[model samples]
Target: MKRIIVAITGASGAVYGIRALELLRKMDDVETHAIVTSSGQRTIAHETDYTPGEVRSLADHHHNPRDIGAAVSSGSFVTTGMLVAPCSVKTLSGIANSYNDELVVRAADVCLKERRRVVLMLRETPLHAGHIELMARATNNGAIIMPPVPAFYTLPRSLDDVVDQTVARALELLDVVMPGIQRWDGTSVVPDDG
Candidate 1:
């Protein structure tokens, strides 16, 4: 079984992580492990209908954010990789700096040290130099810094469509394919009439 770690931090877009869990649950060959920071729980309550328990129920296994001793904290446990959906800037900083003060960061660090793919769906906007530097540092450490930006070429008709497409693309970075996801085929682009 491909074990994938899905972390939900305190970023504004909690649904990204929740949606990722929901989609991953459908895959028979994948086993999902979830970690929700305290702040992430609050964000889910504020932004979505899912309670913390509901979100936890979506995953095959759930780990507490404070459980630094969890199996995922060590490189020996083995995993496909980790996806930090809506990764907060604080989480990004921790991962970039190797500050494994929490389980989420610790697990991500373990994955990076093991040469595994770590995708961070950063949800911040109007970033300054500090945010950019953190992203660069994480990228340098082999983490994929993917900001959850929606693709217009897909012609997303609703907010759900946008979220699905963005999450699908992010998951793709972790080598987890979401079946029937809308992909760019280059046919939507129009020729330059100028």
Candidate 2:
């Protein structure tokens, strides 16, 4: 099983993290380790129907945000990758700077130092220079900043479609194959001009 560490932070888009967890649990090859920040718990309660306990049950292993000694908190402990769905700006800043203040931050820091794939599903809507700089720093340090931006071309029929598309892309960043979203391989054929 490929071990993956997933962190859910206090970002406003709580549904993204919840959906990602639900999807990840369905995949047989992944052994998911999850950390839900205190603020993240609040956000989940505020935005989604799931409780933190429910989400915790989905993970193969669940760590407390305060547990600095967790295996995932060290750079030496091996893992397939890490993903922070609905990563808050606060956590993003921590990851970019290598500040291991909390367990989630520490795990992310470990991912950067170990050169493992780290996917950050940044959830904030508005753009700012500081956010951009943090994104650049994380990317430079070998993390993928994946904002949950929807594709209009897909013509999604339900909210689940949008979530699946984003989750599939996030999985792709970790080199995990997901057939949830129909990919764009440029153009498969010429468009019919009837």
Candidate 3:
């Protein structure tokens, strides 16, 4: 089974992370390892119907944010890569600077050093120069800084549709294909006036 690490932080878009886990669970060949920050737990409670325990149960394995010595904390534990869905700015800073202050950052750091993909679903807005620079830094370190931006062309029917679209894109970076994503076919771009 291929392994992936999914991390959730204190960002406002906790649903993004939760949706990512739920979708990943659908793939029988993929095993999800999750890390939920203390702040992330609080955010889950604040933002979604899912309890913190429910979120943890979505993954094949779960790690504590404070567990700096977890298996995922080391490069020896091979994985497809790490995805920090709804990544908090604090977590982004840690990954960009190689600071392993916690398991979430530590695992991402290890993945980077090992030349594996690290996708950051950064959930922030009103970016200042500092945020842009950090994103650049993380990009320079081989991390994909993907904001959870929705594609409006899809004409999403509900909040769940928007979430699924973003989550599918994130998983695509890790080579996981999810069904039901409304991909742009370019045919809708032009009206056939015939």
Best by lDDT: 1
Q: Which residue pairs come into collision in candidate 1?
A: none
Candidate 1 lDDT over residue span 1-194, tens digit each: 99999999999999999999998998898999999999999999999999999999999999999999999999999999999988999999999999999999999999999999999999899999999999999999999999988888877789998998888888888888887676554676332221
> Per-residue lDDT tens digits of candidate 3, residues 102-153?
9999999999999999999998889999999999999999999999898888
List candidate 2 stretches off by more than 4 Å.
Answer: 188-194
Model 1 poorest ten-residue lDDT run:
185-194
For residue 57, model 3's alpha carbon misses the true position, in angstroms, by 0.5
- Tell me the whole-model lDDT of each prediction, alpha carbons only: 0.93, 0.85, 0.91
Please provide the root mean square deviation of candidate 2 (C-alpha atoms, Å). 4.0
Better candidate number, 2 or 3, judged by lDDT: 3
Residue 17 alpha-carbon offset, candidate 2, angstroms: 1.7
Worst 10 residues of 3 by lDDT: 185-194
Greater lDDT among 1 and 2 belongs to 1
lDDT rank, highest first?
A: 1, 3, 2
TM-score of 3: 0.95
Q: Model 2 scores what on Cα lDDT?
A: 0.85
Q: Which 10 residues in a row give candidate 2 its minimum summed lDDT?
A: 185-194
Could you give candidate 2's per-residue lDDT for residues 69-91 as a string of tens digits?
99898877889889898899999
